[model samples]
Target: MKKQNIVIGVAPTKRSFLSMEEAKRQKEKFMAVIRGIHPDVVTLVDIDDICENGILFETEKITQVVEKFRRAKIDALFTPHCDFGEEQCAAGVAAAMKVPTLVWGARDERPNTDESRGRDTQCGMFACTKVMRRFGVQYSYIWNCETESEDFRNGFDSFIRVVSVIKAVKNLRIAKFGARPEPFMSVTANEGDLATKLGVTVVPISPNTVAARMDQLIGENSPRLQDYVADVKQRMDASGMKEEAVERAAAAKLAIQDLMEEKHCAAGAMECWSAVTVLGAPVCMALGELSDEGLPVSCETDVNGAVTMAMLQAVTLGKEACFLADLTIRHPQNDNAELLWHCGPFPYSLKDSSSVARLVQGQERFELKKGPITVCRFDDVDGKYYLFGGEGKGVDGPETNGTYVWFETNNWKMWEEKLMFGPYIHHVGGIYGNYKKVLREAARYLGMIFDDADEQGVYSL
Candidate 1:
């Protein structure tokens, strides 16, 4: 597991507590919860050494923590708000460093025996939140009333998971299987920029080298392939799909392993449609299976989706999530509900259906011969959220009433109108469900605009 270095700074002040000992107690409590959440990489800033206790006379104490963390090269700051002290100090540090900050309220929200016994206690912590706002800091707060309520408990769980993902992404290494083709513009990105900004390494390899590695992959009789086949069969049976579908699906899985090793990739995206069409096999289904197996093989070698999928994996921790689903109109009359589907197979877990997976052979994969699907995308620029998608059901006509765009920008509305006037590009999208926050942070670290509406689809460049 890659480590996430998160430094937590605590405020010192006797007012928040009756004595230095009480302040220590409060700090210990918060530290205990935070350490338990992500112990391996979490560091605590001793308020005693920084400010003499839990007292804040000047912003120097907070600044000191920021400087120390900067030296240690911390990824994020987590502050346990004891009153306003937590938010105030955290906001100050964040404003200075511009690092992500999270305000954590203790899991124990129970009132103290003497609520008014101490000055600037938990209530003071709450009051100090305004101080963070005063400093123009961006922070997330999670208040849990013990680990009893499902809501608070779940929220805390999600928060910790999200933090872990942030850490994981900052330390991840990805192999960019081949050089960017001249025709694929959106796929063009600076490798060094990805490392410096997103904390992710895009290791590039020659296509010939990838092909050699993939060619070495063993077939079905191999132990790993056998296990994969058996598992697929069992899942198919459970899913209640036809026997023929199961067999074809199993073959497709074997093909993925071959491709993975041939490409020498943990994940991949390839131009395999021509080969698949020649072999009369399901290329998209293979892509979907590789994706489900923690490796997302995108068609057209979409580097952006591969990056997005990696962040999603870190966020969902391998939950049922994929980054390609359209948010187009499902029906001409009902435009509110966006259609969510892919020309390729997405995991049934995300779709929550009992349908068996099957291979789509021939040029049918590119044909717009399907039911209504939704098109959706997420964008989070500097933590400000903006996501807009609509449902568009397929209709029998040359021109479609929907648009598939990459990023949402200032001219998105105009672009949508222009695309709507043209032939509907049979639904192109990724999974959509409040994912703006999930991908935006990743993009921020990568120094790419989260919402680039004028990018004009990748092919144009």
Candidate 2:
């Protein structure tokens, strides 16, 4: 997971209106709240001891404080709600940092008193919004309602969104096992381009080196691999797959440890199709286990998919997730439906497969029979909002293209109608939930086209 340093910005209230003690207490309380959500250093701008209520919003004061926050390298800025006039200061600091800004406001609920406080607080938030608009900056908002009120749900939601924003700004490290052979255009990516645009560093390693490291796991010398293989086998046993597939899966599991260390990768994309298959080893099963273990593997050395999956893993904190999908037109009766198929080796736990393991005519050949799965991913169009979608649970269609994993969600509509740009893939896998916005922001920072603007238009994949 990517960790980031967050800087909380605060300014002293004007003394004529707020006593020094009261101002300190208010600032402290707000800072405490922020720390509870994300513990970090708080930078007090110390603009003034106290000001006339409107003075905090003064252009000069705002500019000075904003400059200080920028120098601090704040990932996100949180400040108390203020009148519309005072909002530009916060917006200016956010613009300077080019980071997401959120307004922290207390939502009182004491009947008449509550209404007044809420209105005042919301006004401050609206003021910041206007400043952001004026500067053409993007921002988010969070409100902390009275503890007793039911508004805690929304409060938590906003806070999580802030967390997502932070994750995106922080650079993610992606490991590439090796370059793909020619003819796989969809998967090749320019690492220099990725670093220049998204802040991601592509850690590359030779496939030959990974192979040499795996050899070390063959004997009784590698205790760590032995232990990991045993533990992985235990998990596979609990999965109830056949004995052969399970044992092969275990070996593959051990191999991942060898590869990650040898490659020095936080996440990996593998090309085991030729090597393992020719050697009569279960490469697909191992890749699936590696993905299930949180080191996502995009098959056929798909670099973009590796980056996309890594972004999702960072956002989801390495929970159950995979990118199992394909893009094709749905049938007339299934316009709302899209097929979720896997050409990679998937564990039996991900889907139910038949005992008869054989090569499908069109799909990639595999040793273990594939099964059903949940499918989800983000679809992006540059300079536009992204679409998040999923088709949950279903059997394979009777076609050489492989299995069908069904999913449906209104989240697609939300992406189309709401957020700008998102993460998506022509290839999909099953594991965790969609980190739609997280991937989008990462792509924005990397400056890569998340998806072709004319994807649905004339173009060859």
Candidate 3:
């Protein structure tokens, strides 16, 4: 997870009847709020310096402020109107910086009187937006007037999460091993489109290369391989699995880890089923371990799934591990709930408290913990990429086999309809949290279609 550095530009105007003192005071309050939420804020131009009676009225001051933001490596920009804002100044700064930008203003005081109330920040925001458009600058805005209110806070927080996703995807590199399983054609991705539009680079690794790495590790009895084998034994009760299977699984884990480090890759997607037969063991537990360690590995060589997992990891700042599963079955007891299951690749930390995750037949199997979860996918329709998500909760269900979770949504039928008719497949990424809003907002910021579900119904943009 990368820390975001934001630059805040305060806009005010001498033309407004609002006093300079009041404008300066409001600017300080807005700055304080931002500082509380994000400590790394670059306010290069001080309120006092920008405002004699207005903010950044002079071109020379705007240039200086832009230079400061450039030098600071600012990730995003925010301009809050303290009074009737200087629209040109705000637009000028945003155009110069050319980053994700936001514009907002304080609500007007009630009972407007000629002497007591004169700040028309609402009107100023409109003008600011127009100028930004004329300059061909893309930005976001808080529609509400109350900057101190909860609505504004929510918007700001969502913006930060959106920025985090953008930053994570901009320079992302994924290690793709082999091809997607021959039968599962739905998991295919457009590698060229991903690189052209999202700045993602896929490093293709041959199956023979991986096999050679695994053989070398086993033949040399590498220290890291030995340590990983011992650690696996200490962490998992692998008595049910064959001794040879355990060793094979350990070798597969070392091979993947070594390749990831060698390639300087952030995430990976592997042809798990074929690799299982070749290695004489399943790769589920090994992939799960990598996900737990903040390096997400998707099954079936689903490159897009790996990208979605990486986005979720960044959204959570790597504090939580994400699971990749097939929307396998509908719950037997509840029509509104469905089963999210994989062939035993979920992290051990996500296993339900009632059941311990165990290595059986070379795979770890357990029910997921009951809690709020966010289900999402990054998929494309005819090469146009989109993000789809919904919020649900893990519930109790009958355990069949493999890693599973009983996920219940408010409108399960609607969700199912969307999945069937929309540009998505059976595979989805699951993480513990109600991050539907965050994902939706992020999709909007990234200019991708967001298909989201909530209490009201399913909606898409």
Candidate 4:
């Protein structure tokens, strides 16, 4: 999530019969809007150098626009209807780009006072949608609206997130540090399907490898290791813990991270009990630290859970980190509340300010701060892969053990039924904002079914 590394291809489309000057002016406004909307978060490469007046219309110029975007290595394509667009040309460019795509146009002005025609941006956008389907081009859309309206901005932001998910999964590489714990059959995954369908790979790393690395990292006591130990000390009250325990935890963190980095992995899953056995301490604190730094790791070697965490992290464009938690229990007093807890593996940055952070048996113990949260999972059943997402909010409940929070969904019964009746499990990836809709949109591009817990209208092409 370099944020700025996600490049987008801009296609300003219009009808050649319309005023060329008007299309040019509109293209300028659209370009400015794209640049300003999410400044520094995304890079934009447009067709201005190839298309006449920087507007897409003539069929002959489609190849040039496609080649330019291809050469730029764009992650997504955005088509703005400058006027009644050349629908076929827009479709051609998107089909050629073969990336997550977005289409939209500014609301049209009323016809001239003299009864002359004005730019029918909405009409062109409507035509483009049909051709996009005709050309097998999948895309998201912002409805006919003013370019500066909040609606347009929200849609564009959502589209960018969709692009983020698509780009991330295309190059996703998760490190499977050890086999799944024997008891957790629910966390099993189809690695072959993950590779064939989503282009995701799981790099295997045996526990023996991690143990060797941990031993070497511990013996070093290098400046970097000492700095990490000091950093952890500042994050929590380590007064009751042994200095050796903290140092061991810090080394373990560095060890797993170094291994993942060596293998070029963005996510990881580990057999936690084995890790504890090898390091003489739980790696909960280390796991939390890694997730906080944007490298999500799930305990019990939950590969699918790690994948969910990675997707949820990317959905925020790396601006926010994600957490993987167990949907363990129901609040005794609150019917809709469910406890999301792990054995002190949550990031300290998400710790509740009102609560004191402490280390308990090498586990970081603190309650997570309250906020809107989106609980998501990527799972499969009988070869059918799907993404499950639901929105909730952190709420106060009876204090619990380890690092935890209570998430209250709109409908507790509905959520329970969805998870209970299907190919889902207790492990879920939680991120701080509501990106359920964006997850649904991203699923369309990834060839996964989108399952919404709360009943909502489907917005798909």
Best prediction by TM-score: 4
RMSD after CA superposition, every candidate: 8.7, 7.5, 3.5, 2.9
Which runs in model 4 stand beyond 4 Å of their true positions? 1-4, 112-114, 456-461
lDDT values for all models: 0.47, 0.48, 0.78, 0.85
C-alpha positional error of residue 163 in candidate 1 after TM-score superposition, expressed in Å: 2.9
Q: Tens digit of lDDT per residue, candidate 1, span 1-461? A: 12234555543333433555655666665555555654554565654556664444355576776667677665556665444344445566768766556654444334546544433344655665677677766556655344235544455445544554566556655555455445656444455655665666655544454333333333224566457656755543324445444444455555555555554444454544434433334445555566666666555555444555555555554553454544354434333222334555454344323233333331112213233332333223333322223333333322222112122223434435533432222223444334444445444444444443333433321
What range of 10 consecutive residues in model 1 has the weakest lDDT sum?
400-409
lDDT measured at residue 45 in model 3 versus the true structure, 0 to 100 = 37
Show pairs that collide, candidate 4. none
Q: Assess candidate 4 and give its TM-score to the true structure.
A: 0.96
Cα lDDT tens digits for candidate 4, 27-145: 88767777886766788887768878778889999888888888898899888898888988889999898888898898887864675668988877878899889888888888888
Residue 95, model 3: lDDT of 94
TM-score of each: 0.59, 0.64, 0.89, 0.96
What lDDT score goes with residue 64 in model 4? 84
Q: Deviation in angstroms for 19 in model 3?
A: 2.8
The TM-score obtained by model 1 is: 0.59
Model 1 RMSD, rounded to 1 decimal = 8.7
lDDT of 1 at 308: 53
Residues forming the 10-long window of minimal summed lDDT in candidate 2: 359-368
